[model samples]
Target: MFAEADWVVKLVMIGLIVASIVSWTVFVAKTLELRKATLLANQVRQDADALRSLAEAGDKPALAGSAMVQGANAELLLSADALHDPEGVKERVASRFDRHEAQVARTMTRGVNVLATIGATAPFVGLFGTVWGIMNSFIGIAEKQTTNLAVVAPGIAEALLATALGLVAAIPAVVIYNHFARQIAAHRAVVADTAAALLRVVSRDLSRGTIAAARG
Candidate 1:
């Protein structure tokens, strides 16, 4: 198996090993990032829910922990007399929440592209190594002026090894990439839910403020 493989095929195998290592690293990093993002998004949802309850009770200060909530509260506080403008209040809160959602999504998506690229390329790299190995094996047979199973077996074995190695690298990369993608999608959903909760809080506050103004 060793004798039939040319220098080029060996080099390709080395390159594939490097690629596999890199792809694995990206998978690990992305998994960690997605887990962290999911946790943070859950926290945000809880915080937003609490803020919504406070708003329902005519208190906007309950949203102090969340920057999106804080911005909404600040806006409501600033325009104390503009109680009739529920639409404006809703828009401001939605905008702030959207910005936060975008930020969170950006963080959650990190390293995913690297994983994706590795998954797509690793197989081709392995195939190249196999092709190069087979060519070298044929060249060796030609030079030796003999076609023997023993002589050809090594080259074929090396080619198959290269293909196996490529698959070994690629399969994990593809799996991890898909896993990360699902995590990101879930993260986005949580963020969107939190944003909706924030909007509700802001809208409730606006409605209460309007009623108070009419009474005055």
Candidate 2:
């Protein structure tokens, strides 16, 4: 296997290995990041709800003071107001949702492109190495002025090695890319659910607050 490939093919195989490793690292890192973001968003939404409850009770200072919680509260308040005139509120809520969706998508998609690139390109990189090895093998046979299998054996082995290495690098990348794609999809689902929950909680709070003010 070692004898069949030319140096160039070996180099390509090495490069493919490096690329695969880099892509996998990105996948792992980004997966963790997305998970963290999802958790943080959910926590912030929950805190916002608690703060909204306190606010409705006329409690002083609440979690709404936190920047993250404040944003969620503002979004909720804006949405509840727009409910009375949906046409006006619809645009604003949709715009806010769009921005949040974009942020969630950006977080989920981190590092996936690199994984995709590795999956798509590694096989071809291996093929190039095999072709180069075969060419070198043929060249060796010609230089020896013989059609002997022994003269061509080393080049063929080198070509096969590169091909094998390419597959090794590419297979994991493809699998990992698929795995992360699913994970990101799941994370996005969580974000959507949490955002909806936040909207509902805020809507209720707004209604209560309005009733209290009316009675006073």
Q: Choose the strongest candidate by lDDT.
A: 1
Q: Can you write out model 1's per-residue Cα lDDT over 73-99, one digit (the tens) per residue?
A: 666666566666778767766887788
Output the worst ten-in-a-row residue range by lDDT, candidate 1.
Answer: 54-63
Q: Provide the TM-score for each candidate, comma-separated.
A: 0.81, 0.76
Going through the candidates in the order shown, the clash numbers are 0, 5
For all predictions, the C-alpha RMSD in Å is 4.2, 4.5
Query: Over the full model, what C-alpha lDDT does candidate 1 score relative to the true structure?
Result: 0.73
**Leading candidate by TM-score:** 1
Clashing pairs in 2: 4-154, 4-155, 4-157, 4-158, 5-158
Candidate 2 lDDT, tens digit per residue, 1-216?
A: 653355687689779879877876886687778778667666655554454442442332323343323455465464553546534543454456557777878857766877778888888999999899989988988899997989888888888878887888888888888888887787777656655654555455445555234223
lDDT of each: 0.73, 0.67
